[model samples]
Target: MSSAGHLYLHTPFCGSRCGYCAFTVEVGVLDRRDAYTDALLAELAVEGERMGTLRTIYVGGGTPSLMGPERIARLLDALRPRCADDVEISMEANPETVDERSLAAYREAGITRVSLGVQSFQAGMLRVLDRQAGPEQAVAAVDAARGAGFESISVDLMFGVPGQTDELLDADLARALEMGVDHISWYELEIKPRTALERAGAALPDEDWAADAYERIVGSLEGAGYRWYETANFARPGHECRHSLGYWSADDYVGLGVGAVSTVNGRRWRNHAGVDAYIGTLSSGVPPTRSVEHLDEPTRRRERWMLALRRDEPMDMRWAGPPDHPEALERLVEGGLIDVDADHIALTRRGRFVQNAILRQLMEYA
Candidate 1:
């Protein structure tokens, strides 16, 4: 029995790929979109027959906005029965692809939240990232989406690019606030392997510099009335992404489509990475899973601690257990990576900067 409450659908097509992105995305002929949607729905049906009702569904993509209304409607139609009432449906969009009609169609199809990829307000920065949207187009997309009755809109911003200055970043932040989005995901630019940035030898700012930029970003958004709920994501009081919160909180989720990873119950599985392989597998009326791992009890407990540490909330000390290295937690406590209370251990604001180190310490100790 699947019985998962979270659903994630990955739409893998983009008009063009971003420079710093390494996700399993494809830029292909528009003619292939309909077939892609059909295959996605087929995957969803197979998963739904097992997973039952989902309380939240996130439709993320290379650019979901590029899909037409009918395609989106058809996909959602397949998803409707598997979803519970008050399902927090979310979709990631490209500012260049969303229009009034598309926004309306998404709202009508039960997408409650729209996250626009507006990496930077500066046209130069956008070009550096190979982004297709201009400042005007970004503004227009937000206006159109709000006009289409999407109350909870989110925008993504990037920092620490090759030539991004603090002044330019401040301008971008101000522009984002002026756009009136309820949520803002301010991400530092990281050059991952195989991405355009990595190939172009794009130099990322130093870790200290990135951390400083993040601090300033937090200050600016909070000053503008957004709450810093997670490390990269911020929102107005109740507008925090329920789906993402579920991710960091170690809740169960079902991920569908090529290259998607799902964690249901205690088992982790990933679908086939190649689109062709995924489609061929689905054509045989079988789930296109590529690999599966049933995590051991120790692995699960360790993962729970690591996942909980991502949140602003304290980690449960019960899971902390006896450290593999007796002095690890004590050293982190002294170094200020984490703080211990009566029943929980939590990262300090400074600790969040070097979260990987703290988690490594815990895992190494384990």
Candidate 2:
């Protein structure tokens, strides 16, 4: 079971592209989804040999739910050999693609968790983001997921979106909490180059406003009994995402699909982003990897620190510590940015806000 670890499969088909998305997703390619899935399965069959005892599986997307429930069942069936007896199977779905039947089929096929992408409930914000699903559909998807007997349900919300005000964000968060979901992934809207958001010609808020929004989100979520387990994630007590925690803990995981990234045993690789190339390579029994990385000890430790700090996990000073800025580290500790003791150093609540700055110092000084 320990050897099995984690698996992340990226399903890359979407009905319509969002303004802010930078993912490798196929639009109007639903007709070719099955071919993509076939190639995905072929790759999985090869990878499955090595992950015969998987503990966690995350099916992220373009939109996994768009694959239809029957296809989803087939994907699960292909992975059953690798799945652990007690596994946490998580799938990302959008509101429009979900229904009672699909949710029920997903539950029947061993999907234990559903993460619905409900970017915003505000009508205006949804329009600005180019999201097809309405606020009511978002609520209904959660209800159907819960009714289908999923062990846990998570909702994704976007902050820093154009036309999003604090009141609107508050309303979105309130609706999420009202649904009684177990987990939430709240992320700021990042405008990538060549994205529709950039072409939309709206200036984003400055860093100060973004920080203020983060503070409000943290306050609201923590007040509602949710643990800010990761920089952008919250959950009730035990509902934290197991797959993500694995990465933060420096455990090895495999990513299977077009545009997927896999890191295992200090070696990392990424698959080709183009769908045709991905399918062609796998169909011919060749790996679709476009690049590979070898993470040496120092690199791994640095990566671990960066990942762990975001989760507020304690780091052992013996193996991981600020080696360079002895004076700066002390200054930060004195300034209440971090909490330190003999064995471990952790970010205090105040420190979480300046995590990026601290992380940069830790890496640069070393």
lDDT of 2 by residue, 1-366 (tens): 334479998999999899888898988878878888888889987776556478999999899999888888888898887678888999999999999888999889888999999988888999988899999999999999988888799999989987777788889878877888999999988889888889878777777888999999999899999999999999999899999898887788999898898887788888878888888888888778679989887787788788888886777867664444556778889888998888788999999999988877667524
Candidate 1 per-residue C-alpha lDDT over 247-299 given as tens digits, one digit per residue, 9 for 90 to 100: 87778898888889898878899987777777777777788867999987777
Candidate 2 has a TM-score of 0.95
Give Cα distance to truth, residue 268, candidate 1, Å. 1.4
User: Cα deviation of 173 in candidate 1 (Å)?
Assistant: 1.6
The number of the candidate with the highest TM-score is: 2
Instruction: For model 1, name the residue pairs that clash.
Output: 324-365
Candidate 2 residue pairs in backbone clash = none
TM-score of each: 0.93, 0.95
Which candidate tops lDDT? 2
TM-score of 1: 0.93
Error of 2 at 32 (Å): 1.8
Cα lDDT listed for each candidate: 0.83, 0.86
| C-alpha lDDT of residue 318 in model 2 | 77
